[model samples]
Target: MDTDTPAVSAADSRVRRPPTADERTTLVAFLGWHRETLRVKCAGLTAAQLADRVLSPSGLSLLGLVRHAAETERFWFRTVMAGEPFEGLYAGDGAFDVARADERTVDEAWAAWRREVEFGERFVDEARDLDVAGDEPGEGPVSLRWVLMHLLEEYARHNGHADLLRERLDGVVGL
Candidate 1:
């Protein structure tokens, strides 16, 4: 653990869960909430803490989740929806590999995540409608609507993992 590691706090950073809204608004808000959920799980932790894989048999940490989330956002939105030519931020199986992660790596991971999130948000906002489809390599055409729902599912699952990892790391637990 580095003595200079700064504290992180994200308890109040999450967006309120959408109580009622249209399909797109509801989906976007829920996804945004899940995005913030990941941040909350990582709050008040140093890079060492963020990279701590306390759960054995699972090479998962808060920072790893952050990196993975960035990859996920870029893949589904930027690559699939926006049809950008691509190489991933941490291409292939590298996103979850946190063995050598330090403060710099942690910062880079978060920056990538924020960039991808912004891209995804804008992509969703500017689409003609959720019915717009993108040519997904293996799956053929996939709709923005489907992508939004799938992203919601993906974040829900990973955020659950983050919830467990965060508790194991520090015993700090909340929404």
Candidate 2:
């Protein structure tokens, strides 16, 4: 069994952002940082370790976070921005359900996350500008800037949770 099928290297070797850049560049850089942070946190773990409820009573495994992030990516990019049909990868909170998680499940979650992330990048790149609008829940015509900020916050918040989860899993902390 692949005990550590890491998707990224240590946080120290992160993707460096330009010292100064435009709003879009900054937003994308920050989002990329947070995404890499998650990958760093989840590194060096077996399938069982990735799926372990180290915090028990809460099924927020590293694998689960990847799954949910994929879901979020699809929601914001495909459903809201492109008016594409939307469906959750897992039923209800099944994204957080890792009781049956194994190597295959871990691979699937990672692949889905990577796909959504790539699609989101492509969508953003093709947009006319940050001012490009989309229909947000209960809000009419929210701009791409708003979506970027929302996703930034979402990933930041989840990354914090990931910090805790990783620490509990093996006392590995800081990122």
Candidate 3:
């Protein structure tokens, strides 16, 4: 291993190492960092604060964004990456409220978000060698390159919403 490799605890064996390619690694780093940024935005807020509808007329909130992102990660990683069924959580036919507040909603959403991030990390880990062919069977395939670029875009876009909502929530700004 490189001497510069960051030391990790045995308990955190699943933690992935960053790619070595300066540019490519930079892109991936931004997405991964921003994902956590979104998580930070939702931190320490109450359920009511998380479910605040004033953030958007359509009822978008930090909690809802978490749910949406978790589902989005599942859609792309599980459904598209692993070719698994797309019938996982939050399959509510574009209904934003489907991810609305509930007792276990936030917990479930965070679990899923973490799971999807790990899933993404695994994909990228093995992605250095393999070429992911087109999108899906009935859906016209896209290249793995496209998927990577798109995921970065997805997190970046949502992080923008997260930025604004977090600002309104506690006035925290500029990560």
Candidate 4:
């Protein structure tokens, strides 16, 4: 992130568009809105700012949130939904701990997040129906609908964290 980075306008950040009639469409729209909210919260900040743990005694940072969100996407969409063999993004290490305030780290984290998002979108698009099933280890089969709802919940929770992180970093507020 950079101060000069193009700002995501308020209009673009907000979920003003009404969701379609389809359940899948509605769920996807909500999830996309949450994802964009996180990105907007992170926009125009430097790597150091992104990695700063504004809340003392807590290692939570915007950078860490983004990385964790990416991993969450991969775990649900690729590993569970697509039934693909998955490895942890940070080599089994906690995502927050690996969020360094360096150009390379920032670049890699964003790139990985974007890539996982793309894959998730593609998977959703190709699914025949919300009932489409994916096998989860130990949990047995889970429906696409369930996964979408879970993703929405996951993003929404983390986006709230992102909101606070942004406010602490720059006094910026609102989605």
Candidate 5:
């Protein structure tokens, strides 16, 4: 667990930048920040490192976080926003847990996560400043503000995991 390498190497351009004013810039900045945070967490690790399950006995890994966060964005934005059905990438109902990893499977997992993040970005860009209420059945009405706040919460929780996992993988810690 001592890789001790920066996730964003000297050449990778996905490092964090300054955030903008919330009143003007929307929550996309915040969301993007966390997404990049996870990407950085997965940095400098091999495919085996990315898919390592030692963080949890049930197969949670940095790669799992990447996949989970992406699907989460899609679940909230696509299913909740566009009313689409859920056919998740890494989850199955009534299953014991997510699958044990293979190289090809983990690669697909990473791709699915990234694709959903991109899709969510497009959704947010189109919905900028357009407040809409959630119409998902059995859920209370929610504004875009609520959605954004929830996303921030989600990202924050995962970022904590990213911090610990990154630290465990390497000695690097702090923001």
Candidate 6:
């Protein structure tokens, strides 16, 4: 294990179960659950372990997934939902290209991911309703509801990838 890698345990995080009532509450809870699932999937991995592309012929790695998730959160929440001026974290290239096993890279990716998540939570909380819309570059207006749903789908898909990556890395399973 790299000395710079922080020890993490799956049990340290809690994912909220989807609520039975209220559209907004249920959506938020589900999103939170998916987010936590990603975190849990990534728990207890060293920086080098995270960067390993266990599945050959594909560039997918746990660290890359983290970076990709961060970029996804930033794109939907800050750029699409809030209409904030956006710039890609990895600049000209995609998130996966910037993924590295080094401590600095890992730290930056996690910080960016957490920051985007925090901003997303605040943006969703302050929205007047799920009907609140933002303009997409080519798709015209998109509602908060659509964004939330899209985010849920995005996280769920990536969590599946993370699951596979985690299993390949350490034989850990179930999240």
Q: lDDT of all the models against the reference?
A: 0.83, 0.82, 0.66, 0.82, 0.65, 0.82
TM-score of 4: 0.89
Q: Write one digit per residue (lDDT tens) for candidate 2, span 7-123.
A: 545546469987799999999898888877777888777788788888878868888888898889988999888878877788887777776577888888888887888889999
Residue pairs clashing, model 1: 8-44
Worst-scoring 10-residue span by lDDT in model 6: 1-10
What tens-digit string does per-residue lDDT give for candidate 6 at 1-175? Answer: 3332334766746655665769999999999988877777877777788888888878899888888888889988888988888888876546776345777778878888888899999999999999999987877899999999999999889889998998988998886
TM-scores, in order shown? 0.92, 0.91, 0.76, 0.89, 0.78, 0.92
* Tens digits of lDDT, candidate 3, 1-175: 1221112221222224375756557656766766766766666666666677656555677777777787777777778877787775765744246434654666666776788878977886777533575456566786666666777787778878877876887786764
How many angstroms is residue 124 displaced in model 5 relative to the true structure, after the best TM-score fit? 1.4
Candidate 3 residue runs with Cα over 4 Å from true position = 1-20, 93-95, 98-103, 137-139
Please report how far candidate 1 places residue 71 from its true position, in Å: 0.6
lDDT of 4: 0.82
Model 3 is weakest, by summed lDDT over 10 consecutive residues, at 1-10
C-alpha displacement of 105 in model 3, angstroms? 2.0
Query: Which tens-of-lDDT digit does each residue in 58-93 have in candidate 1?
Result: 888888888889998999998899899877888577
lDDT of 6: 0.82
Better of 1 and 2 by TM-score: 1
Cα lDDT for residue 31, model 2?
Answer: 83
